[model samples]
Target: MKNILKTVIGIIIIVGIVAIFGLKNKESQDKKDISPNTSSSPSTLTVINNQIQVKNFEGSDFENITEKSIQVNQGSLVKTSSTGRGILESDNETTTIIDKNSEIRVAQSEQNKTKIELESGNLWSRVKKVFGQGEYYQIETNNAVATVRGTNFGTFFSDKQTIFMVSEGDVLAISINPETKKQIGPESTIGAGQKVIIKDGQDPIIEPLTESDKKLEWYVFNQTKTTPTATPRPSPTVSINPTPTEKPSPSPTSSPEPTPTPPEIISVIPKTINVTQGPVNFFVNGQKLKRVTGLFLNDILIKFFTIDEQTIGGTATSELQTGTYDVSVTLFTGEKLTLPEALVINNE
Candidate 1:
């Protein structure tokens, strides 16, 4: 009997130890799985108004209009609005409007994609097209995806439904059906001057932009200045003089000393270098050079270039006067890296 009791006690002790060790191992694994891996690449934000404030959670730098450019970290908030304008321009020219009282996260940005997650409040975006197809900018709330294109769109997230209004282009609003776990159909194309609302359980409703809903007046602000009218000038009367009476008898001395030959003006011939990346763009003098993929020397990708293993042979050269120049190469991977300056043929 004593032996049996001792054996039972020993078994119970072993089981308890094994159970505790197993539980500890499971807890350790769970902790490892739950911790998220942090990213190093810094995000960027542009403040359009004085009302906005950007906080860099990772200690990465951020820029304002005063600074001109800022490097933002993973978590940041930018404020902006009508009285104060804050515009964030990405490497790809995707502009985000940080409206008043908005909290947004610099979610993720890479060579091919950029995502700005709106935690709360309102935001307006004019996302430029990246290289390939798919959603470029997404505004998500409790249950909606406002897939934005290279257009002007406004998004509002409150305790209620996520509201999207398309001021100048198209946007696809998608929502998930909680019970089915399947994505519902996107609301009909919200064309320019349209608005769409995504509620918790109902389908998206599309409507026209009313006076109260018009947030951005793109055409009004972007219209070109009108040409000024010119006043006609009165013509003045002119008198014709008779030819001077052969006063040059002694003239002709030396046939006017044969006119000195003028120096030759060298005509510069510009060479066009073809640069092919996934897609190519050129900038010169801090301004965007249009249609530069296959063109003349004046078109230089001054600040950016997209290069890959396939772009090894591709080169960009300018027929510029020999002097120190500031040249930068921006890879499509969102890397605005500067290259060592190369000397051109000196004209001097």
Candidate 2:
């Protein structure tokens, strides 16, 4: 009888332990379900003009907000009214403004980078700093990606084309042809007051500032006109004596203004470096890589044949492997900058 009782006690203890563990496991899961994970990084979004509507995947809707900063989510569409302007400040403190009649989708928002996919209309972005390596905010239009590091630029997408204009800083524009699927070389470096247009089924066109299109005068005028109005002053009365009138006729002659000096033109000479290859692999320097990637070396890709007429400098998978390769550096102003000769790659 005692042996049977001992067996029953052991079975009861096991059952109680299993039940306790099951309840604890269910409790932990319930906690997780009740609390969704959210990033603790500090970010803000402000509705600058009209009220903005917010919709979430949990079927939550918020409306009638004049100016409020709240956490935004991916795939959330922030739409503005006719006079509405919304500003989104990312976790990295990047600020972007959505102008009136515009719609922007928060594609990816993270601690490192914040990407906004524009469906239509205009957006002005000012990125303060890049968080880390490989951290960049990508603004995708219908056709291209405007990768920004720390820039102040505006994007306008209409009729399947995107117009990117830099107001203060620079941006790298990358576009892939719709039919050809080949990456289009960005032939232009968009500076402040410069614009680049990317149209579908056509090459990108960059134009300089025209006399009629320049807004520098307007900007200066507006800046100078914002001061407080000056009070009107009464005109000074002049009482002239008969004796002083005689002396005034012999007033001293005023000295002529000094001749204005013309500014000197400084000629810039680009430095050249040479590279030679043996039978090993080598990598370009960081600064050189940045310069090449910035479209300075795009001509090499097009004019690869002048060096090697045969085989087209190797296949797509296997680029030109053997022989000495010379890389020519050039400035944005069409000045030839030289690079040192070094062995790039050797397949043999």
Return the top candidate by TM-score.
2
lDDT tens digits, residue span 1-348, model 1: 999999999999999999999999997784453222353345454432243556555334543334434665444545443333344556655656556566677655444455676777777776557445753666666656777656667888777577788766688887656456367775567887788887776678888888766524432221112223454444444444467754423322222233332211111111121222211222222112221232222335322221211111122323344444333434334434333342233333
Could you give candidate 2's per-residue lDDT for residues 161-232 as a string of tens digits?
Answer: 988877667778777675664667754567776778888866677765455434542222111111233444
- Which ranges of candidate 2 are over 4 A from the true structure? 1-43, 58-67, 177-188, 210-348
lDDT scores for all predictions? 0.50, 0.54
The estimated TM-scores of all candidates read 0.46, 0.47
Task: Report how far off residue 89 is in candidate 1 (Å).
Answer: 1.9
Candidate 2 local Cα displacement, residue 317, angstroms: 65
> For model 1, where is the 10-residue window of minimal lDDT?
262-271
Superposed Cα deviation of residue 132, candidate 1 (Å): 1.8
